[model samples]
Target: MGTRHRDEGVTMAERPLVVPNPNDPRLTRRLKGLDQDRQPVLSDVVVERPLTLYLNGQEIVTMMTIGDYPECLAVGYLLNQNMLLAGDRISGIDYDEEVETVVVRTERVTNYEQKLSRKVLTSGCAQGTLFGDVLEKFREVKLDRTAVLHTRWLKTLLREIGTLPSLYLVAGAIHGCALCAGDAVILYMEDVGRHNAVDKIAGYMFLNGIAPHDKIFYTTGRLTSEMVIKTVQMQIPILISRSGVTAWGVELAERAGLTLIGRARGRRFLVLAGSERVIFDADAGEDAGA
Candidate 1:
């Protein structure tokens, strides 16, 4: 994972919302190094571990992660891959730290031998993999046309997300994904791979009974096809990112009725898809003049 730092899971008590726990022991390792002059230097390197995921009795995939929120990652990966359906009832999620493996059991027996056969290597860090069925489901999803994004909320979301304490700020080598309602960030998740962060957010939403139609999905990484697909799978109408986007990502967003906002730095953003949903309600000098 090219990160000098890692994103961990935990909530900061001082902040009213959930943020990454940069202080966690398992997420980083202290190291001694030397500069060009051979001077002694100390640094914290983010740790990556292999976690194997099992759905029922079949092995799904093993992912490289920062080792926080294993259950979320497992469930999210299954959900995003189309192995787990929205109507499925999860009976239990069992994790074994000794082996770094998680097993998700559901009331419904599942099998995905065919879906697992075809895999596409994605641009996601830590070798993000996507199954073929994901796109099939993508075409079938119909997002809420009534969902909208206000400029004021977008501005506020940018400010709050930046100020929150995160492992990315502390360690330096992680990506983040946030689930927001209006200007409020409902949850913040981070990991070595942008895919993992997104998956964690998805898993958290499924586990918590959170609805996605009226929410905004924000990420520190670029808007890629994988990102677009995952957001559509979650059924979120507005996807905002401070980073840039890919042509394919924009195309997918357009096809899925997603309001994709990118290059959202400072007070400017480019809405490449679903522009009809923007309300442009922010005031002048702090606004997008509607």
Candidate 2:
């Protein structure tokens, strides 16, 4: 999540609000700008709103979100939390922007209490947290070890998906998450919070009946514990990003047997876990860094 400041001397109406721009040139630009001082300013204001997930008129979880795609976030959060068995279970979602809340209607009351009770706090910029023992469960996930991805295909996927339309492109202060199958980017989402973006993608995937195992997850944000857990929950074996990863995230990915590739800039990348899935070019020689 982004941050904003209001001077005590200035009134709230008079203060300048800085918002986040996920598409800032500094991070997304193909070429660095010559006039560094004249760079475009991205907003830093983190959009905060409450999302209420309801099952048969009973409230399940009231989440504090960055509020962009409320429906997707609600559904995705439920899916990640293991409260949702299938996308068809969600009957409807109603948003009340005036009250800053979203109401989700589901077919059945999913048993989410156990998962919710295991919340583990983290040190993320936002109020980032996760459910405990979730990482341990990932250890049981058996992936197809020989599912090789070519270096050329990886580059193509990144380049093509990187140019796709996003909330970051419009707001400049958001994070983007996408699902790529084969050479096509099937879904893309952006939000003021990285978690929200991931949730949106997850929700879309769920609603569309897209199997996670055959797809690769991509993001323009840091690979944190929540990010790793979300990917694991989706059963997506491969995750690629242009950002860095946390120690715990790397550990979880390794235990979950996921192929995590980070720092995917241009022709280079770092595979923090499940290196066997990434097949380097023969012409690049055996010296190619993993």
Candidate 3:
């Protein structure tokens, strides 16, 4: 058996990477806590484990995640941080449960000492970090203008998101993200932090060679600068959430021409940026221009 990478660059197993079961007991623990009525009760809580990612044997950064799809997290985190190049050939991904680490091996030598030296805490709930100016490439990046989101399709997607079985539904302390092709969700991931969910989805897209231009990204967390930047980096145009958006997020979305939709729940939702891409067939409203 040899290592495999996508795009015929490296070789992997015929079967996909072994992703941890979302319902795995190891990912959650039974804890004792007091309820609102001050009653002591035992409940299941989501687990947070530290995963240190190494690129080409060099230590990168340790991320606190829910311990699912760690391979994707490692590769996706590196990609979003700009440490991993688009054409970089990934030779292998190795995970050690006892050590709690993930190493991403690439055919090309990778060193990001200078980039990792500079780090800024982002607005992500899990306290996401950024290596360099994550927005540097946004100026040249343009989303597909022809991509359109129908009002009905948007509603259908939200409804589907609500019906999905998630960690949040069971433990009540996680954020989730969904990658949708039209009204169908291709992948759904949840973690203790929203950033982790986004990173997992990014990893899935990267490894599976999924295109982003026509996909819709939905998150259970508020739309922040970090979320907006990561979504754009994924080259996804439409971002929707049941929560509200921040000023910086709105500004960035407008500049990058990314369709930003937030506060979406039920029949009431708002489109804050890239309004022209939204088709009002269901609502018959005016174009949601920036």
Candidate 4:
């Protein structure tokens, strides 16, 4: 099917698949006496589909993702890779489900040169690969603004945001990614692969005229180099997670001058980079120690 952009622009609710009632009567009664009843169970039905991203007619990369929001995933992937400058740069996106490929048509083909230069293959489940010197590219990132995150605000945002529609809540086999402006979550997405979730958010942002310079990104997954690059590509200043950050992830965040917060739960979180953007009260410091 040909890619169709929303006439009124894209909305967060339009991109991610939603499950109306996660605590359905059937599952609720079925798990009444189970110890892990409240925990999201992993489903074996999740299958990986190959999504080939074509930039301006030139084939980019083939990513394995849960087959939802194929157009958003493709556009977002290109945006994250810095292969796209603006929403208008993309002429169209064609998703051929029969052949399982996504062809992205762009107005200018020159932007993808850097990404097509050198490819490094990795052993990641999502067909992870990096083009050119990823570390060096991150070093040149110039963030537009910084987000000052308070402990209370972080706690409130996470709690409020977690209640939104998510694939993990329904299928119990996906990761979620969100874009927040202060305590308000503007975008949220879920996918069997965390990268796809982030990519979906990126795609929605691109199509909706949302600039990442003034936003905070949150994830229910580990902060890796790929994740870090995605945030950097959006020019987002802060990234918070209920997980851990890899050494490379931390290094990239520091180099890009982005704030990295991990293990964000309750009232405490570890700030790995850009501590200046976090505002903590003196009393909270004492409470953390106590």
In lDDT terms, which candidate is top? 1
How do the residues 117-193 of candidate 3 rate in per-residue lDDT, one tens digit apiece? Answer: 88989989878998665768656677889888888777777887777777787788899898886667778888888
What C-alpha RMSD separates each model from the true structure?
6.5, 12.5, 5.3, 6.5
What is the overall TM-score of model 3 with all chains considered together? 0.90
**Structural similarity to truth (TM-score) of each candidate:** 0.91, 0.74, 0.90, 0.77
In candidate 2 the C-alpha lDDT for residue 91 amounts to: 67
> What is the lDDT for 217 in model 3?
90
Best by TM-score: 1
| Model 1 / residue 233 / CA error / Å | 0.6
- Model 2: per-residue lDDT, tens digit, 53-117? 66545566666665656667777876666666543456677877677666666666555656667
Error of 4 at 193 (Å): 2.1
Candidate 1 wrongly placed segments (more than 4 Å): 1-16, 36-38, 284-290
lDDT score, candidate 2 = 0.67
**After TM-score superposition, what is the CA distance of residue 202 in candidate 3 from its true location, in Å?**
0.6
Off by over 4 Å in 3: 1-22, 283-290
lDDT of 4 at 247: 96
Weakest ten-residue segment in model 4 by summed lDDT: 25-34
Candidate 3 residue 66 C-alpha distance from true site, Å: 0.8
lDDT of 4 at 64: 75
